[model samples]
Target: MQMKKVKIDSDRCKGCQLCINVCPKGCLKLSNTVNAAGFQYAIYENESKCTSCGFCFLVCPDVAIEVSRKAKPRVEE
Candidate 1:
Protein backbone atom coordinates (compact mmCIF):
# COMPACT_ATOMS: atom_id res chain seq x y z
CA MET A 1 0.00 0.00 0.00
CA GLN A 2 1.24 3.50 -0.79
CA MET A 3 1.10 5.98 2.04
CA LYS A 4 1.75 9.65 1.38
CA LYS A 5 0.27 12.95 2.39
CA VAL A 6 0.64 16.57 1.27
CA LYS A 7 -0.61 19.58 3.17
CA ILE A 8 -0.70 23.26 2.29
CA ASP A 9 -0.87 26.20 4.65
CA SER A 10 -3.46 28.44 3.03
CA ASP A 11 -2.83 31.44 5.25
CA ARG A 12 0.85 31.56 4.37
CA CYS A 13 0.63 30.69 0.69
CA LYS A 14 1.10 33.56 -1.78
CA GLY A 15 -0.71 31.85 -4.75
CA CYS A 16 2.48 31.20 -6.65
CA GLN A 17 2.32 28.10 -8.87
CA LEU A 18 5.98 27.25 -8.50
CA CYS A 19 5.26 24.14 -6.46
CA ILE A 20 2.65 22.94 -8.94
CA ASN A 21 5.16 23.21 -11.76
CA VAL A 22 7.79 21.28 -9.84
CA CYS A 23 5.64 18.32 -8.86
CA PRO A 24 6.66 15.30 -10.91
CA LYS A 25 3.54 13.29 -10.12
CA GLY A 26 1.17 16.13 -11.02
CA CYS A 27 -0.70 15.63 -7.79
CA LEU A 28 -1.28 19.29 -7.02
CA LYS A 29 -3.45 22.07 -8.38
CA LEU A 30 -4.67 25.58 -7.69
CA SER A 31 -8.01 25.81 -5.96
CA ASN A 32 -10.80 28.08 -7.24
CA THR A 33 -11.68 28.92 -3.65
CA VAL A 34 -9.75 31.75 -2.03
CA ASN A 35 -8.17 31.68 1.36
CA ALA A 36 -8.63 34.13 4.19
CA ALA A 37 -5.67 36.04 2.80
CA GLY A 38 -7.47 36.36 -0.56
CA PHE A 39 -5.02 34.14 -2.39
CA GLN A 40 -6.10 31.10 -4.34
CA TYR A 41 -4.31 28.23 -2.64
CA ALA A 42 -2.65 25.12 -3.89
CA ILE A 43 -4.20 21.76 -3.12
CA TYR A 44 -3.20 18.12 -3.32
CA GLU A 45 -5.43 17.06 -6.16
CA ASN A 46 -4.78 13.34 -6.24
CA GLU A 47 -3.50 11.73 -3.08
CA SER A 48 -3.22 8.40 -4.90
CA LYS A 49 -0.50 9.79 -7.16
CA CYS A 50 1.59 11.43 -4.45
CA THR A 51 5.08 10.06 -3.91
CA SER A 52 6.04 12.06 -0.84
CA CYS A 53 9.10 13.34 -2.69
CA GLY A 54 8.89 16.74 -1.02
CA PHE A 55 9.43 18.56 -4.30
CA CYS A 56 6.41 20.75 -3.66
CA PHE A 57 7.65 21.61 -0.20
CA LEU A 58 11.08 22.58 -1.50
CA VAL A 59 9.81 24.74 -4.34
CA CYS A 60 7.13 26.54 -2.33
CA PRO A 61 8.36 30.13 -1.97
CA ASP A 62 6.06 30.82 0.93
CA VAL A 63 7.02 27.53 2.65
CA ALA A 64 3.38 26.48 2.67
CA ILE A 65 3.50 22.86 1.53
CA GLU A 66 4.31 19.79 3.56
CA VAL A 67 4.68 16.15 2.44
CA SER A 68 4.98 13.10 4.62
CA ARG A 69 5.07 9.32 4.28
CA LYS A 70 3.35 7.00 6.67
CA ALA A 71 5.46 4.25 8.19
CA LYS A 72 4.61 0.81 6.95
CA PRO A 73 3.46 -1.78 9.41
CA ARG A 74 5.86 -4.57 10.32
CA VAL A 75 4.95 -8.20 9.68
CA GLU A 76 6.25 -10.45 12.42
CA GLU A 77 6.61 -14.18 12.00
Candidate 2:
Protein backbone atom coordinates (compact mmCIF):
# COMPACT_ATOMS: atom_id res chain seq x y z
CA MET A 1 0.00 0.00 0.00
CA GLN A 2 1.17 3.49 -0.83
CA MET A 3 1.21 6.34 1.66
CA LYS A 4 -0.79 9.50 1.07
CA LYS A 5 0.11 13.06 1.97
CA VAL A 6 -1.87 16.28 2.19
CA LYS A 7 -0.22 19.64 1.59
CA ILE A 8 -1.94 22.90 2.40
CA ASP A 9 -0.97 26.14 0.68
CA SER A 10 -1.70 28.67 3.37
CA ASP A 11 -1.05 31.53 1.01
CA ARG A 12 -4.03 30.70 -1.19
CA CYS A 13 -6.37 29.68 1.58
CA LYS A 14 -9.41 31.87 2.32
CA GLY A 15 -10.20 30.44 5.79
CA CYS A 16 -13.23 28.60 4.53
CA GLN A 17 -14.20 25.65 6.72
CA LEU A 18 -15.88 23.76 3.88
CA CYS A 19 -13.00 21.32 3.59
CA ILE A 20 -13.01 20.72 7.34
CA ASN A 21 -16.72 20.01 7.34
CA VAL A 22 -16.67 17.81 4.20
CA CYS A 23 -13.87 15.50 5.31
CA PRO A 24 -15.62 12.27 6.24
CA LYS A 25 -12.48 10.94 7.93
CA GLY A 26 -12.46 13.92 10.27
CA CYS A 27 -8.76 14.48 9.71
CA LEU A 28 -9.00 18.19 8.95
CA LYS A 29 -9.39 21.00 11.49
CA LEU A 30 -9.21 24.78 11.60
CA SER A 31 -5.91 26.11 12.80
CA ASN A 32 -5.87 28.37 15.84
CA THR A 33 -3.17 30.52 14.23
CA VAL A 34 -4.13 32.90 11.45
CA ASN A 35 -2.44 32.90 8.10
CA ALA A 36 -0.70 35.82 6.37
CA ALA A 37 -4.05 36.69 4.85
CA GLY A 38 -5.40 37.11 8.36
CA PHE A 39 -7.81 34.24 7.89
CA GLN A 40 -8.08 31.13 10.04
CA TYR A 41 -7.70 28.23 7.63
CA ALA A 42 -8.23 24.55 8.07
CA ILE A 43 -5.35 22.07 8.41
CA TYR A 44 -4.86 18.37 8.57
CA GLU A 45 -3.83 16.84 11.88
CA ASN A 46 -3.92 13.02 11.46
CA GLU A 47 -2.78 12.68 7.88
CA SER A 48 -1.98 9.01 8.34
CA LYS A 49 -5.68 8.33 8.42
CA CYS A 50 -6.32 10.13 5.15
CA THR A 51 -7.90 7.97 2.45
CA SER A 52 -6.48 10.06 -0.40
CA CYS A 53 -10.02 10.50 -1.60
CA GLY A 54 -9.32 14.09 -2.58
CA PHE A 55 -12.45 15.19 -0.80
CA CYS A 56 -10.74 18.17 0.77
CA PHE A 57 -9.01 19.22 -2.43
CA LEU A 58 -12.23 19.01 -4.38
CA VAL A 59 -14.15 21.06 -1.85
CA CYS A 60 -11.53 23.80 -1.51
CA PRO A 61 -12.67 26.71 -3.66
CA ASP A 62 -9.37 28.52 -3.15
CA VAL A 63 -7.38 25.51 -4.41
CA ALA A 64 -5.28 25.51 -1.26
CA ILE A 65 -5.21 21.80 -0.55
CA GLU A 66 -3.06 19.23 -2.35
CA VAL A 67 -3.48 15.50 -2.05
CA SER A 68 -0.78 13.18 -3.36
CA ARG A 69 -0.55 9.41 -3.40
CA LYS A 70 3.01 8.22 -2.94
CA ALA A 71 4.04 5.86 -5.74
CA LYS A 72 5.22 2.42 -4.70
CA PRO A 73 8.70 1.27 -5.58
CA ARG A 74 9.15 -1.23 -8.36
CA VAL A 75 11.08 -4.53 -8.01
CA GLU A 76 14.25 -4.97 -10.03
CA GLU A 77 14.21 -7.72 -12.64
Compared with the true structure, what per-residue lDDT tens digits does model 2 show for residues 1-77? Answer: 64348889887888889999899899988888988889988878787788888999998999999898867799899
lDDT of all predictions: 0.86, 0.85
Worst 10 residues of 1 by lDDT: 1-10
On a 0 to 100 scale, what is the lDDT of residue 54 in model 2?
A: 93
Per-residue lDDT of candidate 1, residues 1-77 (tens digit):
55349878888987899998999999988899999989998877888788799999988889887778877899898
TM-score, cand. 1: 0.83
Off by over 4 Å in 1: 1-4, 72-77
Clashing pairs in 1: none
lDDT of 1: 0.86
Candidate 2 lDDT (Cα, 0 to 1)? 0.85
